[model samples]
Target: MSLPKELEVLQNFFVKQPNPLLGVETIQVLLFREILDFTVLRTEDTRELNTVITPLSTENDENVQRVAFLGSKQKAVESRQMERLLRTAANEADYPIEECYLKDYLCLECPRCALYGGTNASASKTTNANIKHRVAYSTAFSLAAFEQIQQTTTFNGISDLTVQTGQTLNERISVKPATIFPSIVTLHSVTWKELILMMKIILSSHKYGAESRIGGDVRNTVVGITGGWEEFITPLEFTMELNSEKEKSLSAENVTKILNKYKLLLANQKKSVILSPEQVDDMLKFISGFEIDKKFLTKAYEDVRAYRDVQENSKAKKK
Candidate 1:
């Protein structure tokens, strides 16, 4: 079946090359400002401390793992959101539910689940058949370390009734009104349509992180795509330079300038295209009417079939 016009356009752009093996590589830098006070605990000696959360230096080995974890979690959420949108569109179009919505238990049967990976408890199977992800993040060190960003204090468990008791039962900590971080997400072997959808979810979504209760909205996001890995800026180098310049009292405006400079540099050095949030929104709007195509369903079917065959072969070998 033919895809939506918007999706078709993206697919053509992403798979322009003769070989589909070559997929688009994107580096997305997101600047997040905490709309509400939130806390990210620092653990030491198996105990949680209320120390101020700071950005991890690129030199630290743990930084990669932490950034990757954040990126992976974000991707999972974005994929789920995409699935919901698709399912709703299919329903509105009066498409067969079975053709569009895969049962939760039959995760392998769903295109989104297959791309994001899923576990089938009933079948006792897990499938990891999606694009590879390499990610790294840097703290808004310049703003945080220099205290240029506005921060406020809030007392937890400080209800009026609780305060009535003579004993103080509330704890207070500093929370920033906004936090900015630089992140790079690399996708391998993913289709253009999927990439565009993921980008839409990232840019359009307001909710993020563990602090969703208050509000961890992603305020500004910029994405740049490069044909080769060498074209992207290393997260560590970028963060370190920004942090080093903190002593200069860099304003948010100045920080953005620096980021823009780097983005331009990458564009000049490689075949790169920068996508603004507006562009992503436009694409999503254009594709809102589109439903899942037969191509996607066929791919999911093949993936499920291959997985079951492998499982059966393993069981037979055990016997």
Candidate 2:
């Protein structure tokens, strides 16, 4: 089915970062659908699957595994995880942070640390000062069907029993590919450029949840922008209602209709612009040319190196 123009607009619009100068309040919600079966969230206690098809309930069951579930108050994606991913992406892009560490100091020279957070204090006997993260993530809910399976281990190429190991089975569970989960991220007082960088990291996320060995591709992303509205129907709520009405019969037309509904709701209240595909590409191109402060990084690296040398020399003198 063809995509609704409104939904298409939203999809297109999300590719670029919002303008910080406009001083408009905006929230971008992304739905990361799994493209492969993965075992990320698991229960603490091993239990057999029940007849009903639903998320494994952990309440009152101390033995149940602590898995990330939909509609749960617990965050599905934490800010720390986002920070780590961004750091990895930055390093891969050749924007490595030069200062690894100093005497109880964090390498704040890096973009990830600057955008996420960092600390300079060392651990004390009681506690340590920690840098607070800037981004906030919502709990993610599973939208696709799940299945339970038995995990196993086997050995081969041995003739004698003494020389061979016995086969064993393990307990495991998996969510099917195409399963969708809705997650929201709220940014506070960040520049448009920084937000764009964060978006790039998110869009580049390939695997998340538990097992990276098993693929868990982020298949599709749809971002919704809102201003002055602190509360709007969450993507989870909207998707749930749509799923109920569609009875799991997802189609292009139905999806488009849902997006249009949301778009209409936003348009009625405030001005909005959903980036087109071309616009998003243009933004990416612009970001490529953006330059970072090399002088700041150089100074940070030298300071960290000097501090390390002093610490090492003091230890040597004591010895």
Candidate 3:
């Protein structure tokens, strides 16, 4: 997924890679999600529950265990999950990747390595180097409070988003269907390709939270995107800004309106540019039509092989 030369102006939004990430340049994005079905988003069992206490209103005083989508949950969706999907797609297209998909293997050369930071999966600090994750995600909070918007049930018989009562004995807690979670994702020093791909991943991905293999169904929307030297806002702050409203849904218009307030800070107008609804839609249309072809996959594999060779050669020298 690449942009045209005319769109090179958008490159101003991303920091030039191959350089240190000073955090000054960033692309702040707002991602809104709706719970389509049963989704498990919990840390640990709290009396067989997975929730945390947090403010739930514009007042910012109330706190409760509304279904919270942790940052780690979506990070995995974008990193490990997206990487696995890419590999599968490549192999299906007959452009098989030599790099293993095992998480522990940490080929260290895949597209996500530098984009999603990780510990030296080799578990050897001296031999392997860690990559910095350029993208950052924030935990999303449900608009509806826990008591009103969550359901718990015990059942069996499930395959690909269906629940059967007699299949087996399983019990879990999930938020009510159609619940909304307003989120913010920040990208630091990402290239044009990385930024667009992130949008595709966010808007296209269907599953979220724990136990996603069976029953974590979600739909995500890219509300708005801002490019600037500073991160515009957080999920919590975005929530607060819209808390006064009765409806908690995402639309390109509302998103632009809220973010437009922060377009200029103090007397500086160059700090950021909040994309208009039309611009956002244009980008969305482009991504929907964009296809990752054999050429892209071939170059991706070549880069992976080259990076792995370099890392191996470096390790050998250190030995």
Candidate 4:
């Protein structure tokens, strides 16, 4: 029914209903995800998401492609992350869960559709045509350069039945353990329950990038939440700012300080309220225990029906 006192400052950002336009409030979440095992993040061409760039510091003598995480990869994983919980919520609310995909058939009538967005081009139907993504994601690069973070290993495919190695060993290039990715995700026009759902996903998601089922164990650590009309701190900025500190010796406390650098600014106007890591931890714990109630899912489903009805009426009038 309400947010905890620690997260109360973000109450104003939560909208009573979802609106593509005129939803000015934004909640930017800061994260420092560390790779526990390894991940294979690639570019559109399927090659490793690494490109050569000038040396970030004196560590590198020449320019070389640095492996970086891409925004699309993050969005895909996050979008997929909501599937199970969304279906459960729909079942609890007594609504049919219409399956949706990344770029395939979009039902355009689910909470997942509302948050991640989708497009329906069913030539005959035009109701609720397009849904804009409420959650925004940006790419984050490893704090360590690609060379320093990458590891190559060969593994033989052994047959379970025969217990024999395959004809050839396969090579895998992945981000090594302890590699950190500083990322920020922005949520727009979301309700309190939606916000809680998002936080839960962030806390629970442990894998990212390719071969997620097998490897790619990245641990997500949300340092804080900044609420306002606009209070976004980019991953590039985080990487840059943290790079200097990293040159010496970077610690969790240093990262937290970097996250709060912009908080003190524009305080008079209430543009944003940045949470400290301690405060963030407290809020995370509070939301972890909360569940997505049936009432919230019901309202979301009702909105979908209302939108479809309105669109149908408009199309009828035109015809």
Clashes of each: 3, 12, 1, 4
Clash-forming residue pairs, model 4: 51-65, 51-66, 52-64, 52-65
Q: For each candidate, C-alpha RMSD in Å?
A: 7.5, 11.1, 5.1, 3.9
Give the TM-scores of the predictions, in the order they appear: 0.55, 0.54, 0.80, 0.82
Candidate ranking (TM-score, best to worst):
4, 3, 1, 2
Taking all chains together, the TM-score of candidate 1 against the true structure is 0.55
Ten-residue region with minimum lDDT total, candidate 2: 58-67
Candidate 4 lDDT over residue span 1-319, tens digit each? 4455756767788876665553668888878788998788876555455544634543434444556788778878777777777776677867666666556566777667778877766332334657778899887877777878888878888999999888767777788889888788889878776787788887778878877887889888886687887755777767666666343435556656765665555433456666666777788888887666776677666665655566566668898
TM-score (C-alpha) between model 2 and the true structure: 0.54
By lDDT, highest first, what's the ranking? 4, 3, 1, 2
The models' CA-based lDDT, in order, is 0.43, 0.43, 0.68, 0.72
Q: What are the per-residue Cα lDDT tens digits for candidate 2 across 153-178?
A: 23245548687655544544545455
**Superposition error at 44 for model 4 (Å):** 5.4
Number of the top-ranking candidate, with lDDT as the measure: 4
What is the per-residue lDDT of model 3 for residues 1-319, given as tens digits with 9 covering 90 to 100?
4455534546777643323234566787787788888788877755243556766655556665666778888887767665775787787788755464436656555666656655665633234566666788888777667787777787766666654445657777777778888898888867665665677778778887666787778888787888787777778767766664553445678778777766644244576678887777787787677666777666555544454566567768888
Winner on lDDT (2 vs 3): 3
Worst 10 residues of 1 by lDDT: 60-69
Look at candidate 2 and tell me the lDDT of residue 180.
61
In model 3, the Cα lDDT at residue 197 comes to: 64
